[model samples]
Target chain A: MKANLTIISILAILFSSCYKDKGNYDYAALNKLEIKDKNGVINISIIFGDTLRLSPEITQTTAQNEENLTFEWMVFDNSPASSYALPKTVIATTRNLAVQITEPPFVLSQNYRLTYKVTDKRTGVSSFLFYNLTIINKYAQGWIFLEDKGGAGDFSMLLPNGTVEYNVYSSLNSAAPMSKPVKLEITPFQITDDMSPSSKKIYLLTETDGMEVSYQTMQKKFNYGFLFYAAPQIIKPTRHTWVSTSTSATLSGSLGVVVNDGKVHTNLVGGFPGSKKWGASLLSPAGNLNYITAPFVAGGTTYTAAVYDVLNKRFYSVGNTVLSAFPSTASTVFDMNNVGMDLLYLDSANVVREYNAVFKDETNTPYLLKFKTVSTTGAPNLTLLKTQMNAPDIVNMTAAASSTLTPHIYYGVGNKLYRYETTSNTTFPQFTFPAGETVTKLKFSRQPLGTSQLAAVTWTGTESKVYFFDVSNVGDFTTYTNVYSGFARIVDLGYKVP
Target chain B: MRSYIYYFLLLTAILAACGKDNRVMYKEDPRIYFSKFATNPDSTDYSFGVKPVGLLTDTAYLTFRIMGTAVDKDREIKVTIADSSKAKAGYHYNLGPLVMPANAYEVRVPVYLYRKPGLKDSIVTIDFTIEESKDFKPGYNDKPGLNVYDRLHYKISLNDQLLKPASWDSRLALSFGVYSKTKFNFMIVTTGKTDWNSTIFPGDQNFLIQTVKLSLYNYEQANGPMLDENGVRVVFP
Candidate 1:
C-alpha cells in the first residue's frame, strides 16, 4: 500500500507537468478556449487615436480561434510601482473588442487614466495590455482695470499678471507723475473710472527711465479772487502786516487753504475741507453757512445774498435762494438797499441791480433783475453772451434756461477772462494777465484785500512761476496789465490748483 | 413494553400539533420609523460669527424608531443645497450608521461640520428662521471676475450700489454657516453676492465656507463716480 501511495503521488505530479510539456502547443489553441482562471485577466486598447474607436492589437501572440474565443478582461498599471488590477467590473465586448472602463467623469483641468484587461474563461489562460490616456482643459480671459480721478481714485491699471495698480496723480502738471503705485493682486482683472471727477481720460505715465508725462483737455479758465468770492477782509494795508496785494486768485470754490499765524488751516469756507474725511459737510444750511459763485449787494435796498448751498457741491444749482444778510454773520456794514449799493459794475450803462432774484423781464426773457419771478414753463429766454456787456454775440448757453440768477459764465474772448454776473445781467468782470504766459488755474482767494472793493486773482506765467492781481479799483480795471508781473502768485499758499 | 408504547404515542401527538403552525411569532411590539433627527443649534452657518467658530455646545436630541417586523434598522439622510451646474458638488450632511436601541428614545448630539463656502439648501434649520449665515470678510483685490457662491441664509440690501474706487483694489470678505439633521454643525464661506470680500486665514476662529474674487476697479464707469446695476444673490444647499 505504501509503495502504491508513493507511485500515485509521482504519477499525479507527472500528469500535471505533462499538460505544459506539449512543447508549448500552438499559442492558437490557448486563444481558442474560453478562459476561466481564478487569477484575473486584463485587456488593453487604444480607445481613441485615429478615429474615436478602441483599436486592440495583440502583439506578443497569435491565436487560431481569436474571433471565436471570448476574452475575460482585467488590467494592470505598467507605470505604478506595485501591481494593480482593474476594478472587477472592467469588461470587454467582441464589438471592436473594446474595453469599457467604469468610473466618475474626469474633473476639469485634471488628469486621470483607466486601464482595461481581459482573460479567457474556458482555458485557464490570461493576457495583459494597456494604453496611456490623458485629459486637457480650457482657459478663460478673466479681468481688466479702469481709472478714476474725480471722486474715484486717480489711475487704475490692470497688469499682465491680473493685478490692479492705483496711481493718484497730484496735479495735471505735465512734469509731475502720480504718487507711488499701490499694487493690488487679483484675477480676471477689471476697473472703472466713474470715481474720477471729470468725465475724461486722465493718465500719468512714468517710463522705465522715470520720465513723467501728464495730459488733460483744455477749457476756459478764470481767476478765482477777482470773481465774487472776495469780501469783508479789506483791512486796507494794516500797519502791522505787509500788504502784499494779489494780482491773481483762483476761483476753485472756498475749500482752499487759510494761512493763519504762519500755519495753514482749513477755513472750511463753503464747507468740505478736502481733508479726506468721510461725509464732511460743506456749506450746509443746517450749519448756517451757505456759499455761491458770486455774492453781492446793490441799490439802497441791500438786496438779498445769492447764497449757494455749497454742501450739495453739485455743478448745477437747485435750491439757490436769495436772502438778506442776518447780522449774525455779515456785520451791519453797507446800506445795501440804496441804489448806491453797487452789487455789480456793468460795462454798459454803468448800472447795477441789487437784488437779482430769480425772475423774467417784460419780454418774458429770464433776466438777472433785482426782483423778478422766473417761470418754470417753456424754455427760459436766457442766452450765453460774450464780454459782460448787455449786448454781445450769444454763444450756446449750455445750462438750463429757467435759472433766474446770473449764471457764472466763463469764456475766453481773446486774452481776457470774463465772468458774467447773474444778478447784474449787463455786468461781468475780466481777469487780465499782466504778462504773456499761458494761464494755469482759476481759484477763489481767502482774505480779500479791500473787503468792500477788491477781489484777488492768481495766474502762472513762467516755470516755478506765480502772479497775483487785485481788481478792486473802479477805473478801466481792464487796463491793469503790468500789475500781475510785479505780484508774486502768493507762493506756498496751499491752494489746490487744477 | 406497553408503558413505552404509550409515551411514544403521546410525543407523536404533541409533534403533530406543532406542525400546524408555520409562521414565527414574538410578543414584543414592532419597531416604528421615527422622523426626528439631531440638531446643533449653537453651530451657525455664518462664516465669521459674532462668536468663535468651533464645536457648538447647544444640541438637540435626534431619535428614530422602526415600526415594521423586519429586523432592518439602517438609516441615512442626504443633505445638499442647489448649486450651479458648472461647480463641483459638495456634501451637506451625512449621518453614518446607527443601530436602533431596544426601547424608543430621543438622543442629543453636537454638530461637527460648522461652515463651508457653498450655498445653503432647505431641510437644515439653524434656528427658528431659515437664513443664510454671514461668512464673508470684506477687503480689496485686483482679480476682475466672479467669485465663489455662499449657501447660508442672508438678507441682501438692494438700495446700496456697488462702488469700487479707481486706482485701488476693493477690500471685501464674507462668511456663513448651515444646520444639519445628520451632522451636528455645518458651515460655508463664499464671495458675498457683492464684490466686497477678501480671503481670510484659518487660525482666527472662522467656520464659514467661502471663496474670494478680485479685480482692479470695476463697480463703475471709467471716468466718473457711479455704481453698477448688478444686484446681489445668494446660493443655497
Candidate 2:
C-alpha cells in the first residue's frame, strides 16, 4: 500500500508538469522570398544544353537583418521541402548558380523545380522559394527512328512539324558516340502518378561505361519509375534481341520489361513496382528464368499473355499464378501481339490459339492448325502447330491499332502482310509493301483514347522508307500512305501520339 | 484477460462471416429454364438459302436445359409453333419434339429449318414456346444475356443467306471473327451453346478457338476451313 501511494504521487507530479506552460514566443521570420523570371511566375523554359541564370530579390521587414543569414540555392525534381539538415539534393551549390544543362534531369518538355531557400543562423528559421523550369526540345513530340551506325547507335526524331532531325542524341550528349545505344523505352503514354507530361521520359539503355548523365538525374527524382542499365540489379541485362513493355498483370499500373534473353526478366522498372521487379517470385524450378528470354509480347488480358523463350523453345507466361514454365509445344514462337486475345507468336506452322477462359494465359489454351497439309478435325496435329507456323516470309509483326480494341497484327513476310487470326489458326495475305524493300521495323503511333496509326520502316541496299497506313481497319495495308523516305538503316522507330 | 478473450471471439466471429459461404440452400426448390444461350446454338438466327441447282437441307439442333434440379424421370414438354403469315410448319420446315430424359440437365431438339422455294415468298420465323409439362413447370426465366426472343420464347427464322438478320454484325461472336455462316455454325455447336452475350469482353474465346476449331462439324464432318459464300475459306481481314 505504501509503494502504491508513492507511485500515485509521482504520476500526479508528471500530469501537473504536462499542463505547465514555460513560455510562449514567435520566432517565425519577418521575411518573404520573391523570385523574378520571364513572366509573373518564377517559371522559365529552357531547352536542352541551355544555361539558366537567375538573381532573385529578397524582401524583409524592419525586424529582420541580412547579417548572420545563409542562402542555399538548390534544384530538385518534385522532392518535398525540408529544413535543418540539407538533403544530398544540391545539384549545383558552386560559387554561383549557373545550371549547365548538359545531361539528363534535363529531359525535354519536363518541369524541374528550383528551390531558393534562406535560413537565419540565429533563429534557425528557414524560408524557401520554389521556381520551376520547363525543359523544351526542338524535336519534342512525334516518331523517333533509331539508326545503327555499325555498332554505335544514333536516333533521328520525326517532329510533328514534318521535319526529321538527323542526330538528336548528339546535340544533348557529346558521349553519345561512345555509348552503344541498344533499345530505348519510354514510360507508357498514360497518366502517371505525378501527372508528368508526355515525352518527358526517354530511357536510352546502352552498352556499358559511365552512368554519369542518367545517374545524376536519378539521385534527385524517380521519373516515371523507369531505370535501365546495361547492367541492372541482380542479372545484368543488355544486347537483347527483342524487348517489349506492358502494364503488368501481376502488378497493376506498373510496366514490366520483357526481353528475349539468355535470361528473360520483367523486373526492370516502372509504376506497379517502383524499383523492385516482381519477376523473382515467378521462379519455381531453379534456373527456370533462363528458359524465358526475349520475344516478350503483351497479350490483351493477363490470361492470354505470351512470353516466348527462343533459346529453350518454350513459353514462360503468367496465368492466375506467375507460371515459371509451361512446356508449350510451340517450336518457333513468332511475334506475339495482343488485339483482344489474338496470339502473335506462331511456330513454323502459324497455328491459331483459342484463348480458352478455362485456361487463361497463353499456356495450354486449345490450339488449332489450319494448314494445307494438316487436317483440322482430329487432334488438330497438335504436334504440327507446335513445330511450324506456315508463313516462312514472316520476318516481323507490327500490330495495327496499338493497344486499341479489335487491333490487328500484320505479319510482315518478305513484303506481304499476313494477318493472323487468334481464334482460327490461319493467316490471310492482306497487302504487300513496294518491291526491293524489307521491313526493318513496324510501329504504331498511339492516338489518344484507344486510337492508333500504323507505320512501318522498310529498307533496301542503300535506303530506308517509312510508310503510314490506316490501322482503323484491323488488317489492311491497302490504306498505305508514305510518311518519310531516304534514311540509311532504320534501327528502331517509336511514335508519340499526335 | 477475460475482456481480451471476449474481443478475440468477436473478431473471430466477424472473420467467419466474411468468409465465402458457397452453401446454397434450396429454400423451396429454386426454378430453372432453357438457357438463353441454349436457345440458339451460336446465338445466331437459323438462316438458310435454297440452292437453285442442287437439292439441299440443314438441320441445326437447339439445346434444352433445366435450371434447378436434375430429375430421375423422363419429361416431355409441349412446343406450340407461332402461327405467322410467312411460315407454315409442314410447308417450310420440320422441328422435332423436345424431351429431357432421366437425370439430365441438358438435351438438344432438332430445329430443322429448310429453304424450299414457294414454301414462302420471303423469310419466315419458326417461333415456338416450351409449354408447361406434367413433370416440370417453367423452371426459371429472367436472365440478363438472353435476347428478347430467347428470354421468353425460342424463335429462329427461315432466313435466306442474302437476307441475314442485322443483329449478326453486333454479336459477341463477331469479336471471334464469325461474320460468315460456317464459322457461326462452328462457333455454336463447338461451344455447346454457352452464353456469349453476357460474357463477351472478358469471356474466354479459347473453347471456341482451341476446342471447336479442332472438332468436326456435326453436319459436314469435314476437316478443313469453313468457306464463305465465295467458296474461299472465310478470312475476315
- Candidate lDDT scores, in order, read 0.26, 0.48
Those runs of model 1 whose alpha carbons end farther than 4 Å from true positions after fitting are A1-412, A428-435, A438-440, A446-466, A471-498, B1-122, B125-237
Best by TM-score: 2
Candidate 1 residue lDDT tens string, A130-167: 44433221111111121222222233222224343333
Evaluated at residue A9, the lDDT of candidate 2 is 68
lDDT of 2 at A417: 56
**Best candidate, lDDT:** 2
- Model 2 Cα lDDT, one tens digit per residue, B1-237: 655565576568657878887888665442335555532433445444423335456776667677667777777766666676357776667777667877888787786656676534566776666667665566555554535654446666665543333545676444455466565555565555533333332112322332343243222344445676657565321
Worst 10 residues of 1 chain B by lDDT: B210-219
TM-score of every candidate relative to the true structure:
0.22, 0.38
TM-score of each model's chain B: 0.23, 0.53
Estimate candidate 2's RMSD in Å: 26.2
Q: DockQ of all candidates, in order? A: 0.02, 0.01
